[model samples]
Target: MKPLFVTGSSPALRLTVALLLSLTLIFVDSRYRHLDFVRSTLSVAFYPIHYLAALPPRLARAVDGRLASEADLRERNSLLERENLELKSLMQTHQALQAENRRLRDLLGSSFKLRDRVMVAELLEVDLDPYRQQVLVDKGASSGIFVGQPVLDANAVMGQVIRTSPLTATVLLITDAAHSLPVQVNRNGLRTVASGSGLINRLTLLHLAKNADVRVGDLLVTSGLGGVFPPGYPVARITEVRDDPGSHFASVIAQPTARLDRSHEVLLVWTLPALSRAGELDERPLDAAPPAGMDTSR
Candidate 1:
């Protein structure tokens, strides 16, 4: 009557009843832990397939430690921008060697308060011609310079040597509109001339007369009556006087106590013993005379 699907057990009584029900469920799960709630409910039902089989190696070790900390912060920001441009080019070369050692100690204190025979030189080139206030010098005619010589600078009369070349020499400055010079008024010796308004600092005086006692902080100097600069030295300071009663003369103006565009070094003088014979001081004539022991008394 129950032949509908009862083929049931037979292979040796169903393998001895599945080995006696797997040794009676391994002897009741090894003693009496009733299969600990069926092995903790099948390990909480296969805990999300063991955390999705360990995420992809923990996100590949967190993107390889964030690309090795951005390649060690771009190699320490390019070594602090190359040590800040080599400390601002060694602080502008120690402020240009302390302004060339205070212009060589004011040209060795004006060659120890001069009495002629100087030397120094240096300024090799500068005539940008704002009306030709020239410069050049590094000594020429083999250091005996020449062409009307003169040239000073630690403060005063900057210009004379009109051209030479055994090495270099040009000078001319004193403001240069074809220059002048022969000053005076150290406060009263009055005589005048100055000139050169091509202006590197200015000059002009010429024929003063309008009752010319020429003031405005006077000073002028040099008037060894133009033996090419050398009577007392300075040259220019009066800074404007004017006087125009129908212009009989007296406009004044001064200013150039030399540094004409800031001299870099100069002084050549040797005044005149024919400038130590620099070839008979280029055929003499530049008013000529002053130099032996010099001191043309104010």
Candidate 2:
């Protein structure tokens, strides 16, 4: 008993109508781009929700990138700092080597100025007594060092060997109170005796004439009269000259030219008489006849 209200469209007609409408929409959107405005409107309305859903993953990526960059920067800085320290260390070593080279050069240059066969020795000790100016050296009797032998530094005369052992020698500086040497005025050839005053920086010219030609800045050299030191070597330089009516001689003060308190190396000078020139020469003629076993000509 079908009712008359069931007079709606048949199932096949309804299905065909829906399929045709879907096909028409797909064709219109692909060919005419007519849905662009509608799509944009829908995206605007849903944008906040889409962004909220993506926020956590985007924030995590940004934080990770920042941390990685900071770590790389810290490692680079550490590497740079290490390289800087190594460079500084190398610079210091180079400076030290340069200074040592300069010192050695100075020492060799000074050796040529010596007039005797010289042996180099290092200073080992200095006297602590304020009343005496003396130093000990490494060369001794074993090295042919003897008492009264002249001792010199790189610049000038410092002392003479006063005591000796098998392995060491004691030198009495020119500034010792008991020490004296014959020195002449390099400027005017005025010979005088300079005696030490126990002070390292002072010497007194004894028995100098009141009208002596010595001046305040005159240079004094060994006179070779005493036979202890070589002739013409630097001794001391005059620093003060004073004349008194009551005294028979003028008083003069001088300072030694050598770096007495600061020198590290010293020279022991030996002035051995040279062999005669004829003996030193090749006395045997090259053309002289050879023995029976040797041929005269090659």
Clashes of each: 0, 0
Question: Which portions of model 1 show Cα errors greater than 4 Å?
Answer: 1-128, 135-141, 146-158, 161-166, 177-189, 192-195, 199-203, 206-210, 213-222, 225-228, 231-242, 245-249, 252-269, 272-298
My TM-score estimates for the predictions, one after another, are: 0.25, 0.53
lDDT of 1 by residue, 1-298 (tens): 7788758777899999999999998999755656745654664465345345445644665686677766576776677667667867887997797677668868786422224788997764333455677866556777667677787888787878765655566677777765676778887887876767776887777777888777787788887655566678887788789886776677778888777775667878776443244344355435322233222221
Per-residue accuracy of model 2 over 71-181 as CA lDDT, tens digit each: 798998999999999989999998898778778878887432323699999876434456778886767677888667789998898988866666667788888876777
Model 2 error, position 189 (Å):
0.9
Please give the range of 10 consecutive residues that has the lowest summed lDDT in model 2.
Answer: 281-290
Best by lDDT: 2
lDDT of each: 0.68, 0.74
